[model samples]
Target: MVSCPFAVSCWNKSFPGSQSIHTQVLEVWLEKMFGKYSDNKYADIVTLCWALWRARNDVVWEKKYSRVNRVIASAKQYLLRWKCAPVTCSSVLFRFVVEEDGAITWVRPTRNSIKVTVDATLFAERREYGLGIVARDADGLLVEAKIKCYSGTVTVEYVEALGIKEALSWIKNKGWQEVKLESDCLAVVQAIRCTVEMQSSFGQVVADCRRELRDSNSISLLFIKRSANVVTHCFARASHRYPDRTFDWSDIPIEFQDCIQMESI
Candidate 1:
C-alpha cells in the first residue's frame, strides 16, 4: 500500500524528511516512529496512517479520486478528535434500533428535557437551501417544527450549521434552557461540543450556536447517525416546498404530519 501513488504522496507530504523512513519496511518504520514520539503524537501518526489507508481503498475499490489536501486535512481533524475525545467512553441511556427494512429510531429524552433535531439541504442549481428544526418534548410529541429556505447559495456544511443556529434560537426563544440539540452532522456536533474548531463560512454560524449553548449550563449537543434523524431529514428534503415559512403547534405541513404522528405513537 505504501508503494501506491496515493499513499506515497500522503506520506511524503505529511512527513517531510521521511524518504528514508519510506525506504524501510512499513513495520520497521512504524516501530521506529513509535519509539521516537510520545503516546499522543504516536496516536496522531497512527490516525494519519489509517486515514491514508482508507483513502487508498476509496480510490481503488470505490473508483474515486481522493484529493491530497483534503486527505491531509481529514487526517488532522481525526488527530484533533483523538486528542479531544472523552477520557472515559460512557454508555448512553438512549437505545437506537434498526429494523430489517432499515428503519431507525432512538429513545426519547428524559422528563422535563426538550430535544431538538435539525437538518439542512442545499440545491446547487437553484442556489437555494432549506433547514429543518424540530423540537420534541420528553413525551416525544412535536412541540414545534420549522422549515426555512434561503435564496442565496451556501455549502451543505454552512447550512447544517445554520440549522443548529436556528435550533438554538428556537430553544432560547421558548425559554427552554435545559435542552438537547441533536444533528446527524458530525462536524457541526463536534464543533459545538468543543471537540473540533470551526472554520470557513460556517465559523460564525457555529460561533452563534456556541454562544447560545454557553448561555445555559444544561444545554447539550448530540450526534446521531443519519438513519435515526429520519424526520428532520424528511423536513430538510421538503424545505424547498415552503420558502421562508415557520410553523408552530397549530400549523404543520401535511408531508411532515406522518413523521410527527409516527413519532408520537
Candidate 2:
C-alpha cells in the first residue's frame, strides 16, 4: 500500500479508489489477528475482528486488560503441573477374581473406606488409552463400573496416577461426600495418603493434590493388588488396538469406540 504519484498510476487509468487511515490500520491489525487463519480460511473472520476490537476497547477505555499478563499466567500454570509431582515409590498391586457365578462378591479393602479399584493401560502402537474403575456397592455386586479411552501416552506410573485421580474426581465432581478409592499401585496410593514435600518442584505437585484431596472429608485412599480389580483389568486389556470385542454394562462414551471391539455386555 503506497501513497502519492507514480509514473503510471493503475488507479488513474482504471478507476479511483479511496484509502482511509482506519482501513490501513485495520489491515495491520488483522494480520496479527488472523495469521493463523491460513489453516481455517472458512472461519468467521467478522466475529474474530469484532472480538479483537472489543478487547482493544476494554483495554483502552477501561484500562482492564493485558495480553502478556494472561499468557504468562497460563504458562506458569502449565509449568507448575510438571514441577509438582508425587514421589514414585514402589507400588502394591492386588488381583481381582471372577466368581463362578460371574458376579463379583467382594473386594478386600486395604488402608480404608469401601475400596474402589482403578487402572489404566495404553497401547502406543494402537494410539489409544484404556481407563477402568471398579467399586462394590452395598450389595457387593460390583455396583459401579467405568471404562473409557484416552489419547495421551506416558509411563505406567503416570497412567496409574491418572486412573486414581479420575476415580476420586468422579465422586468429588458428582458431590459425593464419602468414598474409598482403591488402586493396585502402592506408590500412588501412598502418595495419595501421606503428604510428600521435598523442596523439589515435583514434590510440590503431589503436595498440592494431597492438600486438595485432604479437604474432602468424604474420601479415603487405599491400596489393593491389581488382581483384586479383575473386571477393570480385563477392560484395560481389552482396550488393545488389534480390533477385538470388549464388554461394559455402562453407557459407553463415543470416544471409547468400544463397539469396534468384541467384548461389551
Candidate 3:
C-alpha cells in the first residue's frame, strides 16, 4: 500500500510516519502499531485503511478513481458518523455540525463565555510567520483582536502552537474566566488535548497552553474548520499590512470587516 502513489500521498497527509514502518508481515506490523495507539487513533487508522481499500476496489472493479482528498473526506465522514452514533457511554463528544451547504459556520459561545479564534500565516520566503486572534462575546460581537508577526521559519504545526500560546496569554491578561479557544490547526489542538508528554519544541508550546488551561477550569481549546475560522485567517494575512505587533480593541481592520460580518451571519 505504501508503494502506491495515491496511498502514499494519503498516508503522508494523515499519518506522517506510517511509511517508515518496515515489516515482512503486515498483520504483525499492524498488531504492534495498534498496541501503541490510543483508542481514537486506532479508529482513525482502521477507518483510513478501509477508505484506501475501498478507493482501490473502485478503481479495479468499477474503473472509477477517487482523489486523495475525496478518500480522506470519506474516511472523516465515516468516522464522524460512527462517533455520532447512539452510544450509552462516550468520553469525548465531537461538536462538528455540517450545514446544508456542506460548510461549517461559526457558532456563538454560550452565555457567560467568550470565543476566541486564532490562526497563523506562514510567509515562507520572508522566513516569518503571523499570528492573529479575534475574541467575540456570546452575542458574537468582537471584544478584541490582535495580529503579531514573528521572525522564524518553523513548521506549520509549531506556528499554530505559537498562535494558541499567544492567545492564551492574551486571555489571561484580560482576566477572562470562561473562554473557548478555537484554531483551524487540528494537529495543534489534538496535541494540546492529548495527555502524552510532548518532547519536541512544538510540544513545549502545547505544554505551555495546557498549563495555561489548567490554571482555569473554564478555559478550553477546540478545533474548527478553516471556513469557520475565516475571520482569524484574514486577520493573520492582514498582519503584513501593520507593524510587527498590533492590537485592536475597537477599530476593526477594513479588510477584515467583511469576514467578520460574514461570520456574524
- Give the winner by TM-score: 3
Model 3 pairs whose backbones collide: none
Backbone-clash count (model 2): 29
> Candidate 3: where are CA atoms >4 Å away?
1-103, 244-249
Residue-wise lDDT of candidate 1 within 1-265, one digit each (tens)? 4566777777677765455564447788888667766676676678778888887788779997756655665665455444444422343643333121112344577898888888999888888999888888888888888888889987887899899988888887788857877787776666665745556678878888888887878777777656457668778888888766777657886656655654554
**lDDT measured at residue 36 in model 1 versus the true structure, 0 to 100:** 62
lDDT of 3 at 180: 83
- At residue 71, candidate 1 shows an lDDT of 68
| CA RMSD, predictions in order | 14.8, 22.2, 13.0
Q: Each candidate: how many clashes?
A: 0, 29, 0
Which ranges of candidate 2 are over 4 A from the true structure?
A: 1-114, 198-208, 239-265
- Per-model CA lDDT versus the true structure: 0.72, 0.49, 0.77
Worst 10 residues of 2 by lDDT: 96-105
Candidate 1 global TM-score? 0.58
- Candidate 2: C-alpha lDDT: 0.49
The sequence of per-residue lDDT tens digits that candidate 2 reaches over residues 1-265 is 2232320132122112222212335566345435534534313343323334454567679996534223222222223333333322332442223111111222443333344667778778866777777654443434456666777666666677777767776666656555767666677656655655556443454565577577788776665544344445655665554223323335443323321121122
RMSD of 3: 13.0
TM-score of each: 0.58, 0.45, 0.60
**What's model 1's lDDT at 66?**
59
